[model samples]
Target chain A: MFTLLLVLLFIPFIGAFVTAPLQQRKADVAAVIMAGAVMLAAISAIIWAGGGRFDYSLAGLPWLTVPFPLFGIQVDPLSSLMLLAITVVGFLIVLYSAGYMSELNKEHPTQAEKDRYYFFTLLFVGAMTGLVLSRNFFQIFLFWELTTLCSWGLISHKRSSVAVQAGFKAMVITAGAGLFFIAALLIMYVKTGSFEFSALGQLPPTLRLTAVIFLLIGAWGKSAQLPFSSWLPTAMEAPTPASAYLHAAAMVKAGVYLTARTIISSQAVPAQAGYLMGGLAVATMFFGLILYFFQDDLKRLLAFSTIAHLGYMFLGMSLGVAGSRLALQGGLLHLINHAFTKTLLFLAVGAISCATGTRSIKALSGLGRKMPVTAAAFIIGALSISGVPPFNIFWSKFFIIAGAIQLNSAWGWTVGLLAIVESLAGFAWFLAVVHRVFFGPASPAAAAAADPPPVMLIPLLVLMVLSLLSPVFGLAIITRIMGG
Target chain B: MYLLNCLWLAFAILLAGSVLCLVSKRHKVNGPLAMISMAAAGLLAVFVAVQVWLNGPVTAGIDSLSIAGFPAVPVFTVDRLSALFLGLIGILSMASVLYTQGYLPHYKSEDPRRYYPPFLLFVLCMMAVVTVADLFYFLFFWEFMTLTSYFLVVYQRDNKKNLEAGFLYFFMTHVTSAGLILVTILFSGWTGSLSFTAIPEIYRQRPPPTRPC
Candidate 1:
């Protein structure tokens, strides 16, 4: 087990170093090796499972024990499932990048330029994986920070002054919010003495409240919820590939992951925290809806939508605290489901932009004929985000609502009503956009547009299939766990 | 355990394939080679996931791989939930890798060579993140994941905006790290142990300290 951990944990770092000096041609070799290693490690871990959940930690690494005993590998039902999302969805993005990124780099980069891209991209993937698998807050924090850095890098990849500013804003807000997380952890340490998640319950009520608030603030910044949401839309300055992989799928999810992880690690978190979370989620959703409908840029529109969906996940989490386990389950399922949906949408945009060299919604029209697959994928993605049934997002949203109602608190139901209203509004907006982008006569951009390459199309098809099938799979896992 | 070994063997095959792809990336055949290996790995992943789902959780430890020659008991298990995840991962990976085959050819203006390596590793890191149970290894993978993706983001680095975003992202990530570190310190106190297994037991035994909100 320890051997597997080491291989899985360190391959990317090795790949990064090896690929650093290599030119674009050679770096491809290193990337394949590293990815293969990670895939193998993931499969090996799955194979070790033989069909159930397990938790084991490889401990005793000296450097791993910093101020605390932090180095250890642990995986259970949740993390492993998350692994599926991370690796699988992540792979598709990488694959997409091969086509998408290379196409964008019309100027043949120097060997060093190519090397740097591979290095940081590999590191980002590794960091996100590590963050999810983390067993304790100390380790989680480490991975969490890495993800933030990766987000900044990915966001600013285009290095447009606008992109740089957005990335900077994102970093400042999230990192600043991170101060609260630091403060929370410090309080936890002061009250307790260890870095294990189990001791979270020991903090005095005041301290616990303080920590919870701090943690939420930190998560809000990272996840782009509420007041911090402005950066997410602006981050659309990044390439669509980066937006899909980093913002919509992985990095932003770090905050969601943190929120969920906190609830799991700490027992008996005060209900007030849950209520506060509920309030913020609701506000974020409303904020997202307001922003989502007004976007002229396709990616920015999707970005707002992502912020809204994130709000949904947070809501489910908050409800889990004050209301129902179903809420938590729904929230997590939504998180996973959103990964597929959001990535597809972003990729679809990439295809359209690739075809027409434009990202404006107003500029794109009647693309359905030329880029049928991408248009169809975009429609599905929109519907899923809007909560259409048979699609995965519908079910998760349903569960979140059900969970909220189950709380039986008037406040809970009120929140549920607001969410429903927002969801409905968002749904209508997506439908409208779909009609505008895919149904109308071809705009000038669409006239020249063509379907994306098979590489991009295939991933879209797969995502569509998964989006359709996810509810069944997600529900099965949930029922199994809830049943036992 | 035999199944587990099979899983590892399959992964090793994948690794070999990656090496091959790396060596041959300059050649036209690298695409097919990548697909074949990724497919094989994906199939194995599905196989493992299916077996685990049907059989229940698989838990074991190989202390022989311990660090510092002072064996720290390490366990990694995959249960129904994990298996479910593995299956999803396998399906997605296969689909995406196949997609890459067609996608890479569009880069008539630029070389697609550098994109593949980080792309693959990024996927791999995400997979590792979810399956591992240890806090330390998890963090290691997580950080690596970030670093790799960061590069992907900045692939168009000359644009300048990407650079600014990189800095902000770095700052945010550090703050989160700081917060997380503090939280971990608190948790370690209750159990006096770092193993994740120590957590629930503590939660079960001790109620959270009450505080007036």
Candidate 2:
């Protein structure tokens, strides 16, 4: 089982380096194969981990001054669930990327940069895997930086001036704020002499508050909350698959993972910290929703929606931190749910752009007539991401708001009402995007467009199915994480 | 003994390269000379740092370096924290020195001597700031680092914006250095010593701050 965990963690990294020098077509094949292997490995590791927590240290250097687990793997239900999202969704995206990054596609067609694309994409898979499995702050921080670097590489894949600037902006804001995480880690290490997550609970009250605040700041920057969120929209300049995988699915989730992990592992997190997190999260949520009305570019719209969805997760986690276990479960569940849903939306948009060579909402119309499969995929994804019922995100968002209402406090009720309003607003807006872009008379571009090749459509179909079934699976996993 | 030798070798190489660049007649060789010297020195510094990381703190310095009636202090020390900074400085120096090769060509009209010497000195000052064990000497090297970096920032003296940016950087950093120096002075006064090792004991004795939450 441990070997399976190791395989799940390292195979993508090894594949990433190996694929870097290969020819474009071969690299694409190798990437899909590698992602498939990782998916299988993740399933096995999850089954082995079950609902129980386990930690394994690769090296036993007892003499080392830095205490706690070193080069260690921690397996539990939360990590296992994240593993499923990253590897399974990652594999699908890689499959889609293989078909999308080719001469056959219409929008920005080029097979020339496939190697670089796959390299960073695979590296992100490995980094996200490592990040979720890390047992301690030290290890998580290392993988966190690796995820940032991989996203920077992918975001700037085209090397256009805008892409490069977006990449640097993302790097500077995230990594610079990450310095606070390091400061928190150092404070904890100085006090407890261990980097393990458990050490955070043992800190004296003042130090714990200071460290938690610092850690949350770092998470905010990574997750692109208020004052740090400008980078995410600009990041859409990346290749669509990279945009889907890195921006929409994996890397942004790492921030909420940190917050959720903190809330789960420690009971001593200050109420002030929880309130602070909830307040800002709600603020970022509305911020994202407000920006949505101004975007004509479909990908940028999805990007802002991602920002809002991330806020929901942060809000959920903050509720949990404020003493609502159900909210914590919801937050963690949202991590999985939103990953699948948003990735689907991003990829479906990518397919639209591929077929029509345009992503403008105004420019694209009546796509349903010409690309029915893609239109259906987009509608399903938009609904799910908007937290519509019976879909994946609805379940998580319901739990989060339910938990908020369960708190029975003014803060809880206010945040809950805000979340509900945001969801309604989001659904209405996305419904508009869908109706305008997919319904009515076919525009010239939509008349010419058709469903993408099977390579691309399969992933969308698979994700669409998952988006529908995710609630059941998400509940089971979240229940296990909560020891139910 | 081996760690000490590595440290000395690294410093000696950097110092020799700085001097060589200062006196070099040909501008073309200066870039390569600085690059090779910085690379070799960085590698050695990192090698010593690795040993320090694996084997705990290593003090590689003169045990006694009294000036007149001044209290004797160890010159250099490599602990886990210092070693980490040393490794970062090593990596950054290697990168910036290598970058100088391409960057220098753009500055072909300017005297190359002005650029390479200050750059090497900047790296050397940074290394010294991390390695010096005495708080007083750390401050000394810290100030030197700022000066050399300012010189590098304004290397193209003809650009007014560059000069203004350099001055802004120098002013802001020196103010920071003043705050650091004030804290260092307070610590030295309390501990009755200038060694970094002594300040920790004083810190441990102080009462913890009040909890905000």
Candidate 3:
């Protein structure tokens, strides 16, 4: 069973390898197989790990030192949840890509870029799995760099000058972060004489602090926190599936995961660091939300929204309370909700992009009459991200605010109130975009557009349903994983 | 001991295959074959990594070879942490290889098959950095990984944008590596041992010997 978890981690790579030789027609089939395998693996891991914290260890072989100082793998509740999230969301994104990529391919009949696009898509899933499942810093860094590389490839898949430029920018920013990550790992190894995370926690306070700060820097860069966040909005040049996978489900969330892990494993930082983290989170949330309101590009609006939500998670971490726990839970839960909701929105955008060849909100109107399913999915996603009642995001945002109020600090209250206002403002902006695009008079594009293929619509519909029902299941999962 | 040699052999084979493709002008099937070999080697390395992860640390060496009388015995050790990293390298490299299959075709018209094979070798270098127990070997693999990746980043060498991206990547990576090397040397200088196992006691016994800052 442990081997199965390991296999699940590697299966996407295997699937990716198999897809390399496949023809254009077979690429989608290959993608489905890989995605299905990931979903199955995730389900098995959840069952095997038994919904609570459990650790599985593999024996050392004779070739390597039996107690190899640097080698380890463990699956606890947190990682298990992450694994499931990556796989489930990854599967849907892959499904959505089949239609989206096929449509893009048709638009460029003279160009033969379909095979390369699908291949990178499959590989991205595999790289993400590696990232979430690995147990030590070294492995994490390796997988982290892999994601940067894969992202660059996917972002540049369009072969356009703009796409290439955007891909290059993303690579530099992320790889810059990757350097800090390697430095942190080496420093930790030197200080503690061990690279395993389990061992690092046992190190002296000073050493632990060193490791934590370095790791936090790395995480902040990857998660797109404040000063390092500019690359995320620019990353919108890629196809929608790439955007969905990179922004909502996998890449950006890695930062939150790192911070959560560091906080859990290490002792608290000094009050200064806490305040610094908190201040940045607050600023990022407000700045990102404000910027989101100014975007005419539908996907860019969502990109800014992602940055803002990431800010909320960071703010929750800085608060440090029983409130922090609830806040973290809210933050993490919102991650799951955002994954579904944002992916749905991106898919809808992709469908519209396909029909009209534009993502400009100003140019799109009355699409609801033509692509009603997509329009409806977009509405649900918009509502969910905006924290409207009964949606999963609402519950998460509610807990975040509740956690803030519990802190009883004036700053906490202020940030919490501002967060709510910013969230509502962001929501209104999204609603305006949806109404302007889907509900008003038909634009030239909407008048001629038809529904996207079933391959795409079905996935969007499933995500919509998941968004609707997530609060019920999300609460249960959080309870089980957090030992509540 | 023999198992350790086999691991190195696998990596060496991958390295050789990469070089073979780079030197060959024909460019047919070399890229895919290089990827396959690297993938297989990565899988095998994963098995080794899992073992170390479960048990603790495993060390193996063959003494027959002599490198300037320092004993040319290439040693491989997988500690609990290194095993995790090894597994990650395998998984990541495997995926990259798969993507390269599709990604390479985009460059096939331009005869850029040389890039894929070298990229696989670069993966091996990264794996080596995580698993090599000796400081010298670790540094060797670290530099190799950086250089190889630098080349891969410049796959679009004719394009100024790609060249600039590659330059930035190289600059950032080397700077980080310098910091890492300083840390590694500091610990080794203080402890007088390059082995990972020997450094913990040194750090434990000597408090504030050198401030980390």
TM-score of each: 0.67, 0.69, 0.66
RMSD of each: 17.9, 28.5, 26.5
Query: Which runs in model 1 stand beyond 4 Å of their true positions?
Result: A25-33, A50-68, A104-112, A479-483, B1-213
Q: For model 1, how big is the CA root-mean-square deviation?
A: 17.9
- Model 1 agreement with the true structure over A1-484: per-residue lDDT tens digits: 6577567767767876887788755666666567667767876775575335554555645643334456577765566556666766766765665556554432222233556666777787788778767777777888888878877887777677987898898788888888888888788777786567776787888878888888889899999987888788878776677788775557788898888778876765789998888898999899889987678888888888888889999999998888577678889889889988888888888888878888888887777767768986897798678765447786688667756765667987688768777876786677667656775467887797788677567778888888877765555545443433
Instruction: Score chain A of each prediction against the true chain A by TM-score and list the results.
Output: 0.93, 0.98, 0.93
Chain B TM per candidate, please? 0.78, 0.88, 0.80
Model 3 stretches with alpha carbons more than 4 Å out: A58-69, A103-111, A203-207, A267-271, A321-323, B1-213
**Where is model 2 more than 4 Å wrong at Cα?**
A60-64, B1-213
After best superposition, candidate 1 residue A16: deviation in angstroms?
3.0
The digit string of per-residue lDDT tens for model 2 on B142-188 reads 76687677668866654557756765676567556545544554555
**Highest-lDDT candidate:** 2
Report the TM-score of the second chain of model 3 against its true counterpart.
0.80
Clash count per candidate: 89, 0, 35
Share of reference contacts found in each model: 0.00, 0.00, 0.00
